[model samples]
Target: MDAFSEFIRGITRDNPILGLVLGLCPALAVTTSVENAIGMSVATAFVLVCSNVFISTLRKQIPSAVRLPIFIIIIATFVSIIRMVMEAYVPSMHAALGIFIPLIVVNCIIIGRAEAYASKNNVFFSFVDALGIAAGFLLVLVLIGGIREILGTGQIVAFGYTLLSLPINPAVTTMIMPPGAFLTIGIIMAVVNYQRAKKRAKGG
Candidate 1:
């Protein structure tokens, strides 16, 4: 039950994206398309999960003062691994993601999880926590990306396969711009907050 609670907490009560609002940089930057958002979220999830497990294993030995530096090194190493692999096998995704891929090293979501939860929990729990947070982040990214892609471009494609294409306009066009992303996220956040308030009022 404790483990389940931790999992739920990571997704909702303490979401790294929405609730805690940790990694807004990458969240807002790479979500121009669903594919880019998914790639970035997956890359960050890999690093977060691995770093959390490692940090938890070494928690006892890490000196309090040196822990931050050590954690950064560990996170950076994993980010490098992702970068190399993406460049080698998935060059297009690598190119599309751009600097944001390497920037995962500094993503607050990964670092915050490592310090706050992973460093203190067991390896298995750390994995669960990382998964929950990653899912929550991915959820937000997909929502933002989907809205932008459909409204802006009139089409939604993943890895070259078209999922849905609107017939109303061949090009709404504005959805691909920076302002579209901001507008979509703002409205979504507002709706989510309203729903939460409604649930609370009903004693949920």
Candidate 2:
């Protein structure tokens, strides 16, 4: 397979969040604003790329019987590193993310990629795949965050700077809440499915 095509596929065709439907918990939970979305994306991308490279490198020596255990350990190690780094440099985000940071250990996106792609691929391809998938995840989070933030707050702010300001007496508070997250996701899914159906009908 062409490496470039594979990388593009992860962003559009096989997006971990939008297409594959993996890693939805953080996508919904930490996407209240652009700031939170960026924070979560950075931590997740770090762990995903690190774990993919490491697992792919050792794929040959790792025995099948013990691969799952090995994968968990490897992924956990990276997750812990990300946790510490975020806590030290970005404590606010660290606290904001809460248990979800450590919970990355169980994130199916990480483990699933490790087993399904990393464990069988070369390091370079795995690295490329990780980058593409992580980028796709980040992009989706940012999009969702933007939508929710704008709808719920009537504005968008990042690092104390306002990116957008809308005139609304009272923003729809539900959009930033759990119900809002679900609603945004449901709408996006419906739109995506409709597009896919249309494409299939045209034999594309």
* Model 1 lDDT, full chain set: 0.87
Worst lDDT run of 10 residues, candidate 2, spans 1-10
**Steric overlap count per candidate:** 0, 0
Q: What does the lDDT read for residue 51 in candidate 2?
A: 96
Give candidate 2's whole-model lDDT: 0.93
Count of clashes in candidate 1: 0
1-204 per-residue lDDT for model 2 (tens digits): 988988998899989988899999999999999999998988999999999999999999999999999999999999999999889998998998899999989989999999889999999999999999999999999999999999999999999999998997699999999999999989988998999999999996
In the range 115-196, model 1's lDDT, one tens digit per residue, is 8888888888998899889888888888788888888878889889998988756676767788787787788878889989
Top lDDT hit: 2
Clashing pairs in 1: none
What are the root-mean-square deviations of the candidates from the true structure over C-alphas? 1.4, 1.0
| Span of 10 residues, lowest total lDDT, candidate 1 | 167-176
